[model samples]
Target: MLRRSAVILVATLAAVAGAVSPASAGGPRHVRGTETIPVYDYGTAIRETVWVESPLDSDGDGARDRIAADIVRPREARTRVPVVMEASPYYACCGRGNESELKEYAADGTVSLMPLYYDNYFVPRGYAFVGVDLSGTARSTGCEDVGGPAEVASAKAVIDWLNGRGTAFDASGARVTASWTTGKVGMIGKSWDGSVANGVAATGVRGLETIVPIGAISSWYDYQRYNGILRTREYVRYLHSYVNGRPAEACADELAAMRAASGETTGDFTAHWAERDYRTAARNVRASVFIAHGVNDKNVSTGQFGLWWDALAKHGVERKLWLFQAGHEDPFDVRRAEWVRTLHRWFDHELHGLRNGIDREPRATLETAPGVWTDERDWPARGVRDRSLPLGDGTLGAGAKGRGVTKTFTDESLREDALVANPTAVVPGRVAFLSAPLTAPLRISGEPSVTLRIQVDKPTAALSARLVDYGTGTRVDHFRSEGVVNLATESCWGAATATDDACYLDTTEVTATADHAVLTRGWADAAHYRSLRFTTPLEPGRWYDVTVPLNTYDVTVPAGHVLGLVIGQSDPQFTVTNDQNATVTLDAGRSTLTLPATGAAVTAPTTPQSITTTTLPGAAERRATDNTPVVPLR
Candidate 1:
């Protein structure tokens, strides 16, 4: 087994060498000039030659793209070494001069395989690390369709090369060898590389071990479109940033073809996208996996995590999820340490027959706010109890205190609580709900659901609910979900002359025509206030029933933490245009909000079990530890 000191040495070396250059009195040396930016010089190290180019013509194409990677022996000269392979479009040597910056800022500096350094971390750790620039990208020759068949085949071919080299097996190719016995290869990458990891895992190639795919989407369609809504901004920007200005016009052409085939300047989730969706691909993955996502990531909705989680759970695939507070950038140190430990533990047990205590970690490690991490036995912890409070008049409270009370008013009374315009006022015209002082701290670790029974005179209506946290007069908006229901669907009739209901309603559904749609609701936080919001069109003589589910959350309220729920017609942050002139009524008896609960004390729910080697079927060893850190191999 590899020693802990060795592992820490490798990590520290990689961090220091890759993270920054030795600071000299003269400041730092400047390197390459790209985009008018000066790149800095980082220290470098020499790595032993693991493999030489040994070519093969497997397809009889007479091409030398199929070269077996020379297997590098582990630092400790172990018999079997775990492997991690990464294939990318980024030229391996492109960032050779900025190894320090690449290591420090790019994907949390763990991806220290850039050609410039020549000291790939995986090779030194006794793990065979393979880097191939997929055919047609960089030095490789062939059409680069991204995740198309060529990419998948190339991945399989790499596996074939590994197997053929006799590195993963004996000379006879019949059994494991002392040089490389475990015969497991994991995939690690981000963006294009991350997407290919999933694609390759879906190929069902043998010896393929675990996968860590960060910030990559499986299907191009689901990411660009949701339901029927068209997401034009983010997708277009991504294509422009990565695909444009490249010397390889073929890559750009492929992207153009996809856009042309979709036939919309702004792409919507067409039938084609749904067919190649990642959620569907997730169903075919057999290897254990971990996914990391950023909650405030505007590029991709955090809901994508839920989609993958739900699919894997349904398929009974062993998987884990980690949510971060950072953006699309690599996670912080605490997170990076956890990731390194996880990868080491997983690969150690599977590839080296080490009994490191990895399998004992929780299935999910969620980031509650910035620095807080919580462990759950499974996704969506079981038996989430729901509690509902009422909204009435200007006050928010429990039970009948605010119920059955209608403060009837003339135009003057309505003016006090309402803002008038062709559409409703976009900001500051909403009411907030506050919960009574808490006896102890309460935490919510799942999604929130809300049901509102309302009365309005208009034929069509839209309502939004927002959850907020109040501290020192600063109201921080947390989670939000909206429901837009046509008045006709609720059996209420609008004026016949009222601008053709067909234009506002489609197939009996109310849809948001603007960017601030109800579908765009969800956020991740360490804690939340016991708060609720109610906003809708006000009309004379009609009542409506509505329900909206706020985005999922993992909240921990400290003891004596005051809970406040605010109900408002509109939030300034989300400006809704074209508000219909109407009056709104709230019925307390028929309205309720549900909060998550576990039948037991809120503080003490069932603890989750960690993944361990013992739980695995054919394990050669085992270790027990009380601490959650990965057990060092020695």
Candidate 2:
């Protein structure tokens, strides 16, 4: 860790020193060390206090209640400075706290706007920072609905208030003069605060410039409920932390609400919990955004990045995505310099009208492995050729042209299926596929979908599929959604169940549950399997496959990479009904996994003709090569 830290520090310093242009240095002085700058020294700074009533009458009680904030203005202020608005529930109990804990603003001649929960971090940066306590949290009035619309409205109201105050800083020695209203504000925060940034962006409020939403949830339903499987472990742990760390009554109420909502868990994207989901809100954000997520983030899945990227792309809004190699609770300073540099360039270009060339940088910048950063033109870059391999006898091979090979399993040898549910225990009669070694650097940039054809003697059964990367010895367990289908039930398309024998069923739409219902009485529980397919982009490499316990299936790979397909019957992690006497078959050629393809070059297009290219935060010096995964463009 020490060696790694040193390398990161060195790389950051080199990047900053090399990236900043001589022309972009005039806006604000970059602080390299701590100095007693008057704008940030609370002792010397002029301080003014004020309160605003909640614009939202929460209880429908027409009367508004008060929210608090502390405004600091530098004694000598000139122009309308850029505003930094911080939204958080974490507040200082008393004024006398650690200097680091305070929201420090620009101490060296920048406007410092400090909101209530904001510490002194805003002041030292010369930014007119406003720290707001959304709705009812902290010293503010109204109930804290967390990231609900009401809280979002409250944030907007605060922005509006700041706008009305103009460039003038309060009595405190901070910059609050009307000369600082650039109307372009940047919102920054993490976790719940990050969610607030997302919510405010969704409101489509004007003058809201750029946003940096880090470690935030994009979909509440998919993340919190575990596809409606009632993730008791995660829920319990979270509630415990909330209850212990937060005020007792508030935590208790939240816990109670979660408990009551347990049975309502359904992984369906359209469910009630998804209403407040950030993915839904990301659709409306018009501002330039920089989204960062920890690859190993457990509380919130890395899948959120993909979801948001897709949404933003669909809306034709460009964004920058960075996936760090950190965990949920890790400190932001791990990548602090890069983050600050990125923000500086971004805000300078947008807020200060500086041509910092941030726009010329790749649309997607990812820290693929530990310390290496790679640039790509777009997310899931095209030209990621697809290659499919076949699954058979624990090995992966190129599938016969237009034909699928098959294997069979009987009752006595169904141990392979059981192993997936219990990794320690291997079940017999399980089929596995191992791919060939990768010949080149390849990334399965998108989700893989599968289709299967089989016959089960039993009237009902369930199927599950997963994609694994054997090279890194790490399972790409991340998925947008994992689905299971019940064979006993009639096929349904757009809400219609097919009761006929000849049915072309697409299992993607079918949602399953633990509850059982009788489908048919059977002498032999038999349902013919037509085909099995799993679709995903594969780079140039070989992969491995494992079967979900208890179900019978097949594996087929596309053209560029090797594929491993595992067929099984039951997955303990998922609820599956295992009945007696199941027979499965793979229809040759007819079964296929269709992977989405983008045929264009994977690299970014040549710098746009009209846009002049400028150097970025680290363009000059060539850094040492390290073993880091190439960052993909998004």
Candidate 3:
């Protein structure tokens, strides 16, 4: 054994040696006060705040509106970097993510706990993260115009300021210029926040290179009504109150004006809704987009995403997609690690001009189940053939010989479950039809359409069609009519701070083992069959050919399963069942259901197979009745 003094000296010398040693042999180093420090530290990010000027007097105030922005950047960014922005109204009202984090301000009005994990994850990666408060929200000065010009302009102005074309101010009210930026910008958000991104991109503003809008609304009209049928009567008033969160009297005038101009009584696509339609201005989009949406989202409707995606494709805009089966959810919660990595590469390729192979990769990523994901070269996978299945004599088949055979149903007193149950059983107020058990797996990858030739006693009636799978298996219970249950367990994603933490406990994604699963559904009014912008009521007892377009979906029906189409005159979930009960007759010879089929060629059976009469237990209730706005955090 060595002496105590010798042992102490040896330990002291080893501690000093370890303290001065570099973490890695060839790591990047920075000289600080005669010492060498490793330069790649991810925890040292700079957080600050500023206000960009907007040329909008939406509040009817004399002064122009100013948008408050919270910024975070890498501490060692010696040169200018590109920007990633999220402009939203929820930072003040509903907060963000499953935990609902609000913005925390310092004594001097500087932002502290910025909402989502964008700043916490991206700032350390040599990118600047910006959280912008929309005009009239939080510390910004103006009236929130929802999707109007004022809201769109407020976001565009921030991009302009970064590119040296607009103005911003510091905390002391002094004008400041974004001299530390490369003028490249990318915006990402969900719900209303994503709507702002879409609206701003539709303006073709300079410096807005890309956007990632998750579960966003492209048309405001579709949110409140469906094809001339009023659904949510007080959508505007409800949304205004939900976003503002201030004293109702403060914005009483604005709210009243919004309700008056909404055209709710007529349920028409008036000029007010026209201004809020991003599809009309899609030709002006110059930014590449990455779109993500839940196919089962009743709040923002999958139709909005389908229409916007189609419009962007027609305009030849570069785009990508992430379609899922959840309802009103963010992709981050569903696929966190992959989402973060994919998003990082997308921003780098679009904003930093990095030659990442993201653009060359598959254009679509679809989630089939809770932990199942698949990639495709493009959405609505190529080589889809439309198969027309006829509806006649209580059977859905490929051929219909019974011309005079007719099924009648009234426009009152029927639930969706009762309509889709036991097709062979006699059900009043609705008609149900089902195909024979599929010989092989059938995959549907696009929208399904319904063509009905009918004569009705009333001038107008609500039409609903549901595509269902009748078999015993486990699948995603998409129609969670009674919302999701949040468990006590918690999960952490990205970095966490005292004021704002990127932690969330996953909510439930309803699953069930039953006789059938509602694949997709569609609704329309008979009077608006020809045109949604205009309506012409039908003459009583006159034959009319009406086609209703159903929601888009991608699902694979297992072998031995039967495809079903349930047609009903009214669905109490959406439109109130027409009070005046009217008898409707269907012409079997002309009625057919068109499905976009994928995989092996399937010929519909000429002879109708025996219909299965199994009743699925626990029928899902209807969602979308409530007007409470859900701000999705992506």
lDDT of the candidates, in the order given: 0.42, 0.42, 0.74
Over 1-634, each residue of candidate 1 has an lDDT whose tens digit, in order, gives: 1112333443445453244333234321211111000121121211221221223322224553332232333333323445677666554323211111121112422223333212233344445555555544444444444455555565656665455543332223243333443457777665556667777777666777777766565665544542222343334334433422234553555556555645243233444354445677666777777776554333444455566667777887777677654433333222544565565556555554455555666777766654567787776665556755555443343532555754321111111112221111222433334444345656665556556665655533334455442221211111211111123321111111111110111111111111111112421110011111112223456555556555445455544333433333322222221223334566655666566644222211122212111112111211121111210000
Ten residues in sequence with the least summed lDDT for candidate 2 = 492-501
**Highest TM-score, which number?**
3
Q: Which stretches of candidate 3 lie above 4 Å from their native place? A: 1-44, 245-251, 480-491, 506-510, 576-580, 600-634
Give the local distance difference test score of model 1.
0.42
For model 3, how many clashes?
Answer: 0
lDDT of 1 at 618: 11
Q: How close is candidate 2 to the true structure, as a TM-score?
A: 0.59
In order of appearance, the predictions have TM-scores of 0.55, 0.59, 0.88
For each candidate in turn, give its C-alpha RMSD to the true structure in angstroms. Answer: 19.8, 18.1, 7.3
In candidate 3, what are the lDDT values of residues 1-634, reduced to their tens digit?
Answer: 1112433433432342223334334332322232222232334566677788898876765778888888876677676878999999888887876667788876767566777777755664557889988877777877776788878999999999999999999989899888888989999998888889999999999999999998897887777677766665577777666677345565677778888887776566777788989999999999998999887786677877888998999999999999877777787766766786688779878986766688999999998765579999998877777888787676676654547878788765466666777766777877877676788888897778899998888877778888988887866555553224466764443443445444556566666677776778787778877777777778887999888888777788888888888888766665543424767888877899998887533434466465554545444345344333333332
